[model samples]
Target chain A: MTEPVTTGTEVPHGGTADKVFPPLDPSTVSPQLVWLAITFVALYFLLKKIAIPRIGGVIEERQNRIQRDIDAAERLKDEIDGAMRTYEKSLADARGNATAIARTTQEKLSAEVDRERAEVEAATAKKLADAEARIAETKRKALSSVGDIASEIAGPVVKQLTGKDVSADEVKRALTAGAGE
Target chain B: MPDPIHQFEVKRLFPLEIFGVDATFTNSALFMVAGVLLSFGLLMYASRGRSLVPSRMQSVAESVYEFVAGMVRDSMGEQGMKFFPLIFTFFMFILTLNMLGMIPGFFTVTSQIWVTAALAILVFLTVIVVGFAKNGLGFLKLFVPDGVPIYVLPLVSLIEVISFFSRPLSHSLRLFANMLAGHITLKVFAGFIIMLLGAGGAASAIAPLPLLAVLGITALEFLVAFLQAYVFTMLTCMYLNDALHPGH
Candidate 1:
């Protein structure tokens, strides 16, 4: 094989180069670090000051709204309890008033009935007294008439039976005395 | 003519040296550029039309977005949304590098420790800075556990601090080691095929088997590449989680 050689250039033929692997040097730092730092700082600040805060604010506002809703519910519950208490008290008051009115009405009706009964009884008693008085007077008149007739009959009998005839007035007086006895 | 490790050598396309630094454009540099350009071009093309019902390209783009988005959300919560751009760029960049290496002549940037270390450091510094900014001196409380007994404070804090500092080291090492091991294994198997075929005669017949193994390992390497990238991002999330809520 004819090998072609270049002037003044020593190319190693058929072997690996002296440098097997690249040198591992710590000094060689990527310049991208500068830009990376800048971007990182800027983004961190932006998020901390603006983006994160906004998200946090939204979360806080939601929490606050929930708390407010809960508080409102508690207040409403209290109001309902108050209203219930008022309703219960009013019911008691209404019941008491109804009972009082019922009692007063019963008493008024009973008193009115008692007065009417007494008036009826008094009127009946007066009528009965007047009738009794009339009967007594009629009885007295009949007895007096019977006594006069008896006296007339007794005067005839006495004249026949006795030697001397008795007077009509004296015979009427004796018959009246016997009838009264 | 064929050596196992020979393929990894960096060759300068344009020979230029500046102050002892080989700033000459190389194959590795070329592939890196290609990876960047390819990634940008594909993403741009995919995202060109904003559609309610996604086109094929848009769907691909959206899928990539959603995959990364879900990872971030799962790992970091809503706070991770802020880091979307960084994590997205990191994932795409590493993914492109890994996929690009599967091409015949392309280089894998993530295989290099320097590159991975740089990325690890970036995440490390970001976590530290963010922790400090958010919590101030309270960031130091991360080293002190809440329920530790008063008598064990010294011992516990020492252990905690050491563990805390090991984050970047482990993060960088895990990616580098995985990539290095996979590439080396692939090269070894590939070298077996070459060595066998070069032996000629009946030995050439056996080359297909090693080649098949290399292919299988390459596929597994591809899975490892994605896993490493995922692990790196997940670790970053965990670190950030610590930064966000220290001592937890």
Candidate 2:
């Protein structure tokens, strides 16, 4: 308002009555109103039916698409986690089964070895008893041979000592007594 | 030398008269139509693909949509989304008119107070009708601010009434006066450059100074153009909010 007052006085024709108040022109007002109504109404429809909706649809579509993609990604991540858990569980189960099988096999093998060793020890004890009996028989046979030799020597000595020949039974009895002593 | 105000003079392109009313298709009318057509074309082309991953044009279109949509949602809440079309139309129409006028010879339809006033009237009517329809007589309470003493009620209500009725006038004049003043100032400075150069000698040397000033003012006018359009639409939302919730 102050602008027109200042400029109006400074330049007479520059800020004339028409210039100071352009909208007050009766001819200008009606046509402007009429055209503004018509054009604005037309623009409103264009915006409502075509322009705004188109732009709004694209924006909404982009937002929905992003939301859906994020949701899908989240769901897939959960699935992967579940699968990993299952895989780990199965892996642990397999490891346990392998350990159990190994332990059982070792126990069975050790038991079989202990049984085989017991059988071998029994066979060796029987063989040692048989060998001791054989040695005793051989010692008795050598003692009898010594008695025969002692009887022969005593008979020869008696003959040499002038006329006193001892009987074989008496010499065996003497040798046996000497061997016992 | 073209008169600074002569740019605002309306010339009949098609001398039309309807029922004894001079409804001539003047330069202003032409620009008004041009503004609508330009908005329609740009928006149509921008949203042509409608791809999820938007193209550059689609991005530009969506940016405007989001800007206005957010403004409406913020000012009037979700209920205000229903009026998005009207708000967006005002923004695009006025913005296109303001920008088109920056193109040297083009006329700015928004510079006309009649045009701006008509739009403000539409917004005013919408606020009134919607306000009454939604809240009935309770809408009248908007003028009666709460917590005021009974002694001050009459005086306060009178001031409120005057302010309320002046909404359309202020709304329309804010946009119209800014565009008119900026354009006139630019033209005046531009006219000075021509006048100075025509005088020759030392006067011509000073022509570059005004020429520089015009350049700077032209840049500021562009900024004002966008700002004014944004301000107009923003105020429309605030007024519409008053209709939606008339308590305060």
DockQ of each: 0.03, 0.36
lDDT of 1 at A121: 92
TM-score of chain A of each: 0.54, 0.63
Candidate 1, residue A8: the lDDT equals 28
Find the 10 residues in a row with the least total lDDT in model 1 chain B: B1-10
TM-score of each: 0.58, 0.76
Best by DockQ: 2
Model 2 misplacement above 4 A: A1-24, A98-181, B147-155
Native-to-model Cα distance after best TM-score fit, residue A83 in candidate 2, in Å: 1.2
In model 1, pairs of residues that clash are none
